[model samples]
Target: MTENSNMQSDLQKDKKFQRDPHFISWQWPIVVLAAGCLLYYLIHISDHSLPKEVTIHEAIENTNLFSSERSRNTLRKLTKLGPRLAGSIQNEVHAPALIEHEVQEAQSNAHSSQSILLQRQKGSGAYFLGFKLGFTNIYDNIQNVLALLEGSDGNHSILINCHYDTVAASEGASDDGITCAVMLELLRVLSMQTLRLKHNVIFLFNGAEETPLQGAHMFLKHEWAKKARIHVTVGAAGSADVNFSSADACDRFVRRFHGRLVAACRLSVTVSN
Candidate 1:
């Protein structure tokens, strides 16, 4: 009886050893990783969430607001013209004409308190790209289509820039055409009689960006650049590339712009919900 009891006790110890092994288990690590991922997703997912879409009919009824459908239509028209390379007829002539037409259409509906001024600037200049490039880029008759919306106080201005030119063998719809379309839509919205502005706004549709920024250089030589307090260059959708002469100026503008954007986004989200 004592021998049998000792054997049974040894077997129970073996079973216990099998149940609780000394080796590390992967299950707990996997569970921890999954929990961490879930926590991260819950924390940061809102940044990736999209806003409610606006339909074409809703956009048309609300003429004073921005319309993605209208912008998309404009993009379609611009892209239908095909590639608009620098110095080409499509870039220098046709694109400018289309932009001018759009500006004129916006101007017709502009508020009585606002004045829209359009300029087709022609300029020639040479500038050193950098020591890395080790060459000077020269350009002549680089076209820039500029539209200025004079606000109640026109002493200071904000410049929004986008290029309409593309490289050879590419349609350049996403590269810049969409940005131009968005600018057109913004101009329309800002010109509404219901809205009031404290400072003037300039929309620059540069034609020589694919030529490596010659249009922007030409704009610096223009008298209008003097009044420009802020410069926002839109390379693509959601790209808010800003350039300023001073760090302090950029900081101030960024702070104000960020605050306004956050407020607007919150309002949109609340209204959608």
Candidate 2:
């Protein structure tokens, strides 16, 4: 090759190199800063945010009946089946079956358990009692459970409560199922313990608190109208939101029980009339 040809090649290479910029001045520094910020955030250092926590334990004690894994399994199964609305055929297919299964299992595990006793309403053209669910209405459903557990004693009692039915299209294992699992676990622990209580404890799994308070109205039907001297309802499941609200008797019970656990976590108080 001639010297001119070689020089032409060299010039072309230099021109290509010049056209391709190395560090577009601001781009490199900005990218570096972004990467650094990301790292800082992940590590939760210097105004950073960290990812969510993995479970250490149930965050409660003794009865680990409601593991997140088990609850998740229930959720997935319910999701596959779809929603569980009231007055639907699914009440027979899924809702009552789901709760009855739990009640039986809880009883087998030796908790001082109670069932709704499976009665029926003769009016309304058909039976209504078995059609009614447990976890629907908050205020009245709770009262009915209290009446069942009244056990003919004239004293106050501790109430453990949870709602079991899911919202429309919701496969909610965490929402209220978590609360049910918690109460079941607590009951299991208490049952296992040798200690006896002065006040009778009522375990309530209410139904249909989602829409109008039908279960509640039926529950308070002059029989359990008198509020339990103490009530202990939980936040909708999967929530550690142990708050007292001005909704019903269970709210008062929740406050009384939480008054003991305040040292473990800050208890928010709000009891309804």
Identify the candidate with maximal lDDT: 1
**Prediction RMSDs, each to the true structure:** 6.4, 11.2
- Candidate 1: residue pairs that collide: none
Clashes of each: 0, 21
lDDT of candidate 1?
A: 0.81
Tens-digit lDDT string for candidate 2 (85-127): 5454553356445655654554565434332222211111111
Candidate 2, which ten residues in sequence have the lowest lDDT sum? 118-127
Q: What is the per-residue lDDT of model 1 for residues 53-84, given as tens digits with 9 covering 90 to 100?
A: 56557766776667787788888888878889
lDDT of each: 0.81, 0.47
Query: Given candidate 1, what's the lDDT at residue 122?
Result: 97
